[model samples]
Target: MKKRKTLLLPLARQFTVILILFTLCTVCITIYSTFGYSRLQTSFLNNSLESYSAQLAKSTREAYESYENICYSIAYSQVVQNYLMSENRGKSYENYRQLENQLSNTALLNPYIIDIAVYGQDSTFASLCGSASNYEEFSRSLSDSRFPYRSAGVATVNRTLCHVLAMPIYSLGTGESRYLGILFLAIDVNNLLGNSLKSDENDYDPRILFTDASGQLIYGEPQLYDALCREEDRSDVFQIQETSDNPVTYAVTGYSIPGIEHTLYVLIDKSQITRQVARISGRQLLVMCAITFLALLFLFLLYRPLIRSLKQLTDFMNTISSGDRRAMKEGAVIHQGLIGSKEISEISTAFNDMLIETEKLNHTIFDTYTRMYELENNNRKTEIAFLRSQINPHFLYNTLTMICGLAAEGMDDKIISVTGALSRIFRYSIKGSDMVTLEEEMSIVRSYLMIQKERFEDRFTVRYEFSEDSHDCLIPKMVIQPLVENAIVHGLEKSLEPGELLIGAGRNPEHGYLAIWIFDTGVGMPESRLTELRESIHRSVYNKTGDASADLEDLNSQNHESIGILNVNSRMVLYYGTDYTLLIDSEEGVGTNIQIRVPYRLKSDTNARAAQNTNSKGENHVPGNCD
Candidate 1:
């Protein structure tokens, strides 16, 4: 009694929920089971219906075989095959009549047979249904006389469907003896197929129909054809469907006869069979409901603890959904990691880490964006100053030409050589354009040495070593001129004894750039002055001025006409960036080596034509002056 009381306490708590669920389940099961059972029963009845129809078709096929046999027997008869092989034609009527009588008797045994006919080769004589007749009636309808037999559907004397089966009778004799006649048989079409329906004893409703290759009706009543036609969803076979009318469930089956071109269909209605099964299903559902109610009560009692745990997890998830992260942190301690157990401790730890990491990443992204904005402003100002310093090649060319002419007419080999060097230098300047060919820039430097050689005469000597491959490469016009100027004005120009200048141009494939170095065996600056020049060239060109800070009031103010080493340095850095630049290699008294590394193809050479037009705006070229 104590055990029974404990079970009853749980049953009472789940009574309402289980009752509602049990009622809904019972109704659904009744509906589903009844539908499934009805379908199964209807399928069985359709199989039976198809079986009966197949048996009828087999019987009809046998009847057709019997009719064909009679025709074959006549075709191979000794007298008929002999007459057909001879030239007598129908002159031997008495013998032909005997064969006809035997064939007529054979056909009479076939219930579906309606008539028979025989025709001579010339179509002069014939017999039909045991009566003498002329061939005039079917002469036009006959096709070939050489083959054994042929058949066709035609109207009978009684106005009904019939198939005419005919065979060519050949004479049995020597070659080309004679020509005989043909034997024909008529079979009623409907009666031949209707034999299958007579064997079924069930109350199943059925419809019979015939159609051509296309799904158009050929025979049967109009209403019956339409009813069966609606269910013919496929061309290869038939379909079954539920209906509200008599014979509630219906299915259709179709087959094409082997020798015949027409298709036959048999539609059966088996609703009464499905209805009986539905009644049985309703009783089975009642028994299942009684057993299910007791099992559900026991399961509900056993799952009480699990249900409470699920409610606690659901409440924590709801707190997270409401944007209460603080509450979620506190709840994790109370719940002790998923249902007060060890199952989800890892998931709880991972989720908390993801939230905190996302917040930290957002702060880092904001700080980086602020830094980029400040850097961009400084870069824009420097870019403007670099672009302003690009010089005009044509103006430089005109000025050098004037200087060359003034020094040309003297006999002093010194003066003449200097003037010739001046001429070559001006010519080389024009060749520079925006992208002086490497060959042309080198020629200009050689001319510069020639002029210096005449001025210093035996005091200094210049030599060049350049790779053969560097001739066609394009670099900025006047790119090497600035470095050479620095070496002459600051290094070799101060030397007391004979000084040496060496220019080297070659490719450093390892660095992917062409390096041109100007080395002078002259006074070299200290490391401190070198550092100062390097820093000045690297500073943002935007704030640079033409005045040196030592000679001006405002050292930081921007300036025009400041075409120093810094100007060339800023332009090079702007276009090629940090990749290509000038490197100063020097030691006190030994020499100053200025190495300029540049890309094989400079950006200025690519825009040479445009750069020439822009830089030549303020100057015009004049013709040569003769004195």
Candidate 2:
């Protein structure tokens, strides 16, 4: 019962952790979606306001240009010029009637024209189309200005607000022209902007305004105009927050009409955007909640059977741990009927087999103990033999010959350096622990490469690449050197052209291992040899009882061509396990790559036996790579 409770505690903790992670992910996705959607909606609204403001400004400029053209035509008319040039009283009334008729006909050109009038320099005046009551006042305000055309500002004419324009007429008769009079054209402001100001179906309730360069309002609400003028350094698009006086927040955008010194402003209420975002956020939250609930339900269903199977297995283990022989015999048979997944069923079968083995061990405890002692002693002998195989006599003879050649050529420094590097290799190989820091191992590899460099001359080059952080990681001694040696002897030495050899070590934190690799660009092996080499390296030594001795003898009998690599593989398996062995890959005429993976351990982890056992059985094995 205690074991069952112990097992259940971890499962409960795991379920809680999974639930929390799922909820956190759901919340994060919800927040991101809501924020992104709000930003998208705001961007869309700003673009719409900008487009709307541009359209209104364009229409206003076109209308003003049309009205100015009419004023220009009337100012240069022959009949009007003739009337302004005439001084006869008898023809004055006749000229006046013709001028009035002409003005009436010109007013028909635009439906929004309220009135057209002419004020003469002699204080004479004539009107048509409407009561032109303000024409004299409008023309008198700009009497001193020399400009041919100008706006006379907004005024109440015929009890309606009108946009008035004033143009100075000149006598068309001659050389040094004389100022004849002023022509005033009054246009209905409401009718001019009516079509442009209508709200769209989206119900944004956009307010449109027209103002001069100096911020003088020509059209739109006076309150909004006053608020807009208070803002400093306004850009093409901006927002207005709700205040005490202005209770509505607005998104404001505008455009300046070129050559007219006028700007058009479009203001949209922000409440619409806020409501849209709220609706979308609410829907997202609902979906997130639904998904979270369904995910939690699935987690519960998936883990329920696993939890039950574990509880049953724990009970059986507890019965065995109690050391009651009769209870153990009964529990073993009962657990064979235990059920769950295929993996769980296999585990139950293995547990039963272990129990049956335990019963057999009770009958032959003496024999089992004797064999275990023999295996340990033989394992040590095998390791010693593997170490001896790493020191090649031919390699030493070659290095001595190269030193003699350098000495005869009077290169004393080259001979001394080569001798020193060769001595370091022998000293490091002879006196060291079976496990050493990656830095120490790499030092030996560099020493070995230096000697090889002297031996091969310019036939090959060596490159060392190692991560600084992984320099302190612990690995089996002499494991990487043999791989490097194999890369040179079997791979690079066979090539006619100069070759390159790369040796590197780094931490593979994702897989919790240390990765050491040797790559050579040289004549590579065929597919058949590559496959054969991989099978030989991966082959287990102790597949059954008393097989360790046979495997060691077989390794001794293998050819010298693969003896170095096989020795390295054998040591790694004895120390770490098959799971953390060597990986070899080769392609014909391309290259060969060899990699070694071992559990990442530091000097602080001094218990090598515990580490070996844990790596061999406790952890799942990950496949190797040559990259």
Candidate 3:
């Protein structure tokens, strides 16, 4: 009776339900089956193709690299390096040939190399075993190479064409001017490629050919249409594309050989396997059709329920796509179907994470630009300050000269020493415009010490000792003088008894820097003052002002008495960075010490060299040794 009611229902409604269900189910099943089957086959074949391609590529790459290695080994031979260094022009042709012969015999792996060409800088080409017939042709051909080594030619032997590769040999001299020669290797590319691609199976064979950038064949001369031959347009194709399908049905890969400036390709064919994958089964198709009809009948019985479930899925997708992230965060529009899924939830999470990262990236970029702008502004101001500071020393030097002249006329015994020291100090101030020798800075320090001794006579003594090797090391001018002056005025001037100020300069073997120390036996500083000085030396302008209770606060916030120390420290850091200079150690009652470490070698700087001559005037006199 139920079957009869169903049959009596309107045919269109019943037919539509069954047909719709059948089409949906069969379409889903067939699409899944087809894609799954095709992907598996394609993946398997691609993997095989790639694996075969990789192995062949590795073999060919190793062969070419071996050839390159051998050529480089010959090129960098001590004999060659020594010959180039000795400036042996084209005269050492026989000696170069003997070297080439020895290298050819030594390379057991690639013994077929017939000749080597050494191209000298004068466009003359010389070879160890090549013939005289094509020497002119070879030389003319080589004019393009500029054969910085021996000769300008095709670098041939016996007038027979050969596979060739060459590398530019360089002299071990410093600077951009030391190139000496070009080393050429005449090789059998066919033999190299053949031996490298030797297959294990009898049925499989591989062939390789070498060509120039223009796609003209350069090697494998005897066989034109062999297993490997030049294709009509293959040469042009390889130049443009890195990878392409080989019309021969073989998997292929390309690599650029060093020194050759051309592409080498490797190939493997899979025509048979591809044909097998194309074969389909007729019986299976019939069985699939039967299954489709049965599914249609079952779906008509549950049409209403299916529509309701689809609506639920639609609503879930819409909720996730909404721009309101907060709504999604609350986990609204949950899927409660028997076939539950969490894919929608995961997508939402990933989207939110992406938004968060984008915001952070934007903020970081903005902050970086802002900080860069502020630093540029500060740099400009510092330049202005430095220019202003330069003006006063000239006037100071003139005043000292007049004083020294007056004193000299009166036969003051100490007048000459003071005048000389003061004069040197002024000249160095101008001379150290950019950089000065270690010898120059020491001169300034000696002069400053002299002035102090005259002002505070018999109160203190200073001594200096420096390594002979480190005398040539360059350092900033007037760097040491200011520190010495500080020590005398702040430490020794106040003392009654004679105090000792010992200055020592030497190279530090461990750090590769010059370590200079100024030690004084005078009134030392208290812990509070020492701490304040350290803070001022390291404090940045950005943190100059902050809450009073800030941790690591500036203790010298009252008066910038340590400004000189801070300035020197900052300048040292700005130039060589904090790793180099302005090290201070002090103790109450005992003494104070300052060490300035700088790189021990003058880094060939143009400005330093230009100022070297102008800066030699005042380095000889003792600063405070005047009687």
Candidate 4:
């Protein structure tokens, strides 16, 4: 139950945060749509109408100026001038006909011009434009009676409003000129204004109106213009008006033509644009709500399974702490509790891998420490066995028993000498230290040899050569005694003649090693036996240390003279790291010579008894290459 609460707490917090942010975004969008969309709709309509009105004003003004240019061109022509200057109005009919033809040609080429005509009150040009009453009255008031062609904004002509251009003719040649009649071009104003705007038969389309300087409505419905803009707003370029019939507001845009005093009005009903924006806002709000619903649904559905996976992981961790290693290995480290997060899955996988590796490492460390402890124990036992081998229990019993018999026989000197040697041997072997001065080790060697001589009944002769400088050096305790024991058990006891045993220690001048040699003139070892012994020593040093207990068991099994030599070799290798070993020379009928060389270790014993400077030489022990 606690695990469920722990997992759901984070998910609940996450969902709460997301819901708040999503709601805030929806609110902001709703507020923006409510007020901002309506403002944007009004702004767009105003800008569009303003552009359209500017276009209409520019195009309508150009049409008026074009008609004025046509009238001016005809009035300056040679045909009209000649007709005005001619005296007889009837006989000079060709000039009048020529002038009439020019006016007709101009009217035919211009579609907007209703007619182009010339009137000469004094001359014979035809008055084809019904009448020109205003042109006649204006001509009589002129000093030269010549009117320049110009735009007269808007006036009724032939019962229809038309734009008029009046051009007066003169008797124009190179000489002095007199005024002729006026050439008046009447343009249909209604036609131009009607064509300037797009047809607004559809009520939704924009309605436009053009008004002259005197406030005469030229185009579009007057009702729409008045409803959209007030008299004051019409003077402004852009304005808005609210209507009474409907709550729809209208946009009004007006532009003035450059040369003429006429303004173009463009009106648009803003409610149509409002309805479009409202529909779009409604759809957007619906979609947002739907998306919010789906998001909530997805998060709610996620609760159960994600919490289940988290609970599983929590249980797995608890089991791990309780030491259930098998369960940890079999459980999935990553699953759907990831809840769309790749990083959490990666962390789970890494932790699982770490635990697996840690377990392996723990086992490896245990095995390593176990082997080290066994090796240390085996080294202890080997040293113990070596000390005891030098003073065997049975040998001590027999030696004491022999001394008693000899004392009964009244051999005081032999009993005392043997007992002293036995005492020194035991004292040397019982000391706890493994290191001893070389001279002390030699003393133990002499003691052991004396005991052997008394037991052998004068069957072997002994020889010794010693160097005083090398004798003070330190060596492992009882290292040399094992080699001497092997020589006696295998050499002197087996020879038919009185055998010789040579024991010597010296500095090897060539190798600078402290060389100790043991030679015996007993029956020499066969080459195969010598090889076998050498192989045994070498194999023990290399192969046996991995399992010291196995070596001990093997030693217990073997009954041979090689064990002591093998033991010495193992101890040497263990101490000196494989630098010291035995070198043996032998002949089958002669004797065996064994030499041991060790790195010259200095005497650590500062105040020890001096070695006996004596040699009982039966055979010379050579100090150089004995091979």
lDDT of each: 0.60, 0.77, 0.59, 0.69
> Over 4 Å off in model 2, which ranges?
1-23, 79-111, 122-129, 190-194, 197-209, 213-215, 228-260, 263-627
- Candidate 1's C-alpha runs over 4 A off are 1-37, 79-93, 124-138, 146-148, 158-160, 177-179, 210-252, 260-262, 268-627
C-alpha lDDT of residue 594 in model 2: 88
Candidate 1, position 411, lDDT:
40
Question: What are the RMSD figures for all models against the true structure?
Answer: 30.1, 28.3, 47.6, 18.9
Q: Please name the candidate that would achieve the greatest lDDT relative to the true structure.
A: 2
Q: What is the lDDT of candidate 1?
A: 0.60
Best by TM-score: 2
Better of 3 and 4 by lDDT: 4
List TM-scores for all candidates, in order.
0.34, 0.41, 0.35, 0.40
lDDT of 2 at 295: 82
**In model 3, where do residues sit more than 4 Å from their true spots?**
1-409, 540-560, 603-627
- When sorted by TM-score, best at the front, the candidate numbers are 2, 4, 3, 1
Clashes of 3: 22
Worst 10 residues of 4 by lDDT: 609-618
Worst 10 residues of 2 by lDDT: 331-340
lDDT of 1 by residue, 21-87 (tens): 7768876876687678667766766677778778655665565567667777766776555444445
| lDDT of each residue in 1-627, candidate 3, tens digit only | 565544465444666876877688787787677667766766776665556656655665576567677767777776666655554556465566666666556444565566666665554455666743434444446545434322122234545455666667766546655556666667655555667535564234433455555545655332422334445444422221223753444444555655445556655444544553444322344566777767765664444344444455455457657755554444434343454335544554565566567557767988998997787556634532452233234335644665666576784656777777777776666543455687777777777776666666688877878888777777765567667766775677555667999988898889788988888888879999888777666563334332322312242353344544555554565567557658889887788998888887764554576577557645655688531
